[model samples]
Target chain A: DAGITQSPRHKVTETGTPVTLRCHQTENHRYMYWYRQDPGHGLRLIHYSYGVKDTDKGEVSDGYSVSRSKTEDFLLTLESATSSQTSVYFCAIRATNTDTQYFGPGTRLTVL
Target chain B: QKEVEQDPGPLSVPEGAIVSLNCTYSNSAFQYFMWYRQYSRKGPELLMYTYSSGNKEDGRFTAQVDKSSKYISLFIRDSQPSDSATYLCAMTDNAGGTSYGKLTFGQGTILTVHP
Candidate 1:
């Protein structure tokens, strides 16, 4: 739970359109992560922010970008949507005191 | 080769049966291991976490880590239908640099406990 919420629980967009998904957290945790889940590929990290204005690319960050302007908000944006980018996106927060990471409800996005 | 490997099993079992899920990794630097349970169409939630090599137990779940073999396992005793979900194994190193908060996960295994 970790007081995390993602906007646009479901969305559909055409190819080549820009799309942004927002993740908000109330826990004030220092670390936030974005991941996409697809069949046969459990969960792949897209991007993550360790602190405000600090971010890094992940294993599958080629087509995605992220930003953490504030401790409570992390954003993931697709410059141009693609069919391959269609997947369930999840946001997670890492606890400051422990190694545990908690996840928020996912956003299901589909591109035509 | 992928850093972490797990058999993606759509394993179906009867209620009250013992269930075992496993994952293996090639990175010797991995010192922290964890298991997450994700219900259908929902986000994953942490089910178990262990550091280095050892076993940790909570209620009906047991997480075992064998660092020597770079392997980990999650066992569910007296499984219930509600336990049906996808299980994912994730690992990270304590090296603490740019890799600090990064987690490598397996493809995950699906389990279904029938009543």
Candidate 2:
């Protein structure tokens, strides 16, 4: 509902292959986040972008990289996919004025 | 221990029952609190937000925060089947720098309201 959409709603890739997931927002939010959800582990932050060309690592940033060249788009890439990386990825936009975050539909990724 | 801890209950109750979900945190610096409801295969959606302490009510949902106890609770009155979903508690410290917009989340509690 935040005008956020994730590309490749679902993906399947073999281990050791590089994969990139995309998050697009229409509201022009300044802060965006990527999180991975796994059974029993809950949601863990992967990476986030506060502005164009600005990014930061999160709790579980290893094996993953992010780029925000534009305000509306943020990309998360797995240098080499692994079985441990299989999970549902969610994108969120933080409302600077409201101090709230809204989430996208999410992308389900599987690494064989 | 994890920063935030939740019961992670796969709780099931009859429709119209009052449902209580809770979370506890170890970090006292967390000032902003929020609740998110997520359905199967869907992303989480914000349900309620309360800053610091005290109670805030929104329709049939009530959120209570006790900063001193480092505990937060969500109460749903007259719960409906539509409310059956995983509830996640999230908090953040606006201390700026690395703590800017990062949120720490609970393990989430699964609820099922049966008709």
Candidate 3:
């Protein structure tokens, strides 16, 4: 909601292929996060970055990796797409601690 | 047990009715609480945020947090059809600022307000 944009709003890929989703923010927020949403399940964190080049894995980070090379950009990569990874991906950013997170529209990824 | 528990109700209400959504967490250390609303096929949008115990009201929405009981609630004073969506509760410890992204979320509850 806060000047965040996610690229490739929808994607269909084959298993074993790699896919990258990009999150770009115009607000220069210091914190960025990647999460996946599935039916009946809450948004599960994949990875997050606190500052440029500082990243940490989340509860569901097995096959995913994240990079934050700049203040305005965060990238999430699925090293190898799988059917189980098919879901809606979201990017969120926060400018201060304990503050509300602003989210990008989202990217729907489907791997067959 | 899951750290956060929500009913995930497909709760239906008539227009202008008051609606309540709730979540209970197991982590006693969690001090920050929040509620988010997500429309169908859309990303979750924050509706309410509160820290510690007590309540905070904004416009027609009120958020309540009870750290002693490890529970949180969101009340909509006059629910309308526009309010229909999936409501999610998120919590963290010292979950403020531009760092420390460890907030945990509960399965959202689906609410429908009929006219």
On lDDT, the candidate that comes out on top is 2
lDDT score, residue A108, model 1? 100
Instruction: State each model's CA lDDT, in order.
Output: 0.92, 0.94, 0.90
Error of 3 at B27 (Å): 0.5
- In Å, candidate 3's interface RMSD is 1.7
**All candidates: TM-score:** 0.96, 0.97, 0.96
Q: What is the DockQ score, from 0 to 1, of model 3?
A: 0.70
Flag the better candidate by DockQ, 1 or 2. Answer: 1
lDDT tens readout by residue for model 2, A1-112: 6899999999999999999999999998889999999988889999998899999999999999999999999999999999999999999999866557899999999999
Candidate 1 stretches with Cα past 4 Å from truth are: B95-99
lDDT (10s digit) by residue, model 1, range B4-114? 999998899999999999999999989988899999988999999998999999999999999899999999999999999999999888533444477889999999999
Per-residue lDDT, model 3, residue A6, is 96
Give a tens-digit lDDT track for model 3, residues A1-112: 8899999899999999999999999987888999999877788999999889999999999999989889999999999999999999999987464556778899999999
Clashing pairs in 2: none
TM-score of 2: 0.97
Task: Report the error of model 1 at residue B20, Å.
Answer: 0.6
Scoring each candidate complex against the real one, what DockQ results? 0.61, 0.57, 0.70
Give one clash count per candidate, in the order shown. 0, 0, 8
